[model samples]
Target chain A: DVKVTQSSRYLVKRTGEKVFLECVQDMDHENMFWYRQDPGLGLRLIYFSYDVKMKEKGDIPEGYSVSREKKERFSLILESASTNQTSMYLCASSYGELREQYFGPGTRLTVT
Target chain B: AQSVTQLDSQVPVFEEAPVELRCNYSSSVSVYLFWYVQYPNQGLQLLLKYLSGSTLVKGINGFEAEFNKSQTSFHLRKPSVHISDTAEYFCAVRPGSNMLTFGGGTRLMVKP
Candidate 1:
């Protein structure tokens, strides 16, 4: 079974604080993604990395940035967290050309 | 650009009854379709996917989805649902790009 693990299941942060969400996949997948899931709105892609140090912007990438310095790790960074940034963050990875993504448990971020 | 639309926001069904969650997509080129289930406080899990050959794809937990190219729809179905089947369902479409476009999502509530 493919395993994707997130750093935290729940996190609370004050406004203007920097927040980092980490994800690690054991499957040696080449594609990793970060998404924010809101009620009714479903999941919106925040950022994705096709290869190490390579990134692409998604639909809602304004308030979020991502890093993939290593093949197995992907990190989501909130430069300065805000109340509106609170949501369920998910990390996923897929092997090259397969396009079937496996997801981590998710991190519920609460920006106060 | 590819976009997905889940026609129903929520579907309530009695235990052991049939259920269906509707999804549709709009894209200029060929696309891949997927259905994912997200339990409470958990990340999304792949239920089924339609890449090419077959139109009807079966997934775990006795769930299945049929891809209708002419209608541009991929609707999920289950002959009978259980309490454990309650969750949010998301339909996603991937065009030529590596990124995926997800639908608004449909919440399935199974009553006893």
Candidate 2:
């Protein structure tokens, strides 16, 4: 089974603070995605990486960025965290296009 | 572009009763459909997916969904639900791109 693990399950940060959320997948999948889930709005894609050092902005990418320094690791960075940035962050990895993505335990961020 | 819509925002049902969660999508070409369940404070898990062939897809926890091409819908169903089945269900659609568009989600609340 593919196992995706996140660095933190819960986090709290003050406004304007920079935050980093890390995700690692054991299966070495090529595609990695970051999403923020909010009430009623569901999961909205924030960023995705198809290869190391390559990233694409998803539907909601403002105030967020991503880095993929290695094949097994992907990181989400918030340049300046705001209260609006507080939400559940999910990380997913897939081997190829049109394949099912395996998700890591989400990180619930609280920006106060 | 593709989009998904979950008709019901929340469905409350008694334990051991049958339940159906409606999901509809709009796409101009062929697409893949998926149903994912998110337990409390956890990441999303793939329940099932419809890529091709058989329209009826069975997934974990005794859940199933049928893909209706004509109606452009993939609705999840369970013969009988347990309290453990209570969670937030998301319907996603993958068009020709590598990214997936998720629905607003439906919260399933199972009662005793």
The number of the candidate with the highest DockQ is 2
Clashing pairs in 1: none
**Per-residue lDDT value at A40 in model 2:** 86
CA shift of B47, model 1, Å = 0.7
Q: Candidate 2, residue A21: CA error in Å? A: 0.8
What DockQ does each listed candidate score? 0.77, 0.83
Per-residue CA lDDT of model 1 for B1-112, tens digit only, reads 7789999999999999999999999998988999999998778999999898989999999999999999999999999999999999999998865578899999999999
**Clashing residue pairs for model 2:** none
What's the i-RMS for candidate 1 in angstroms? 1.3
Task: Go through the candidates in order and give each one's C-alpha lDDT.
Answer: 0.93, 0.95
Name the best candidate (by lDDT).
2
- What TM-score would candidate 1 get against the native? 0.97
Model 2 lDDT per residue over B1-112, tens place: 7889999999999999999999999999999999999998778999999998999999999999999999999999999999999999999999876589999999999999
A38-102 per-residue lDDT for model 2 (tens digits): 88888899999999999999999999989999999999999999999999999999988988999
lDDT of 2 at B5: 92
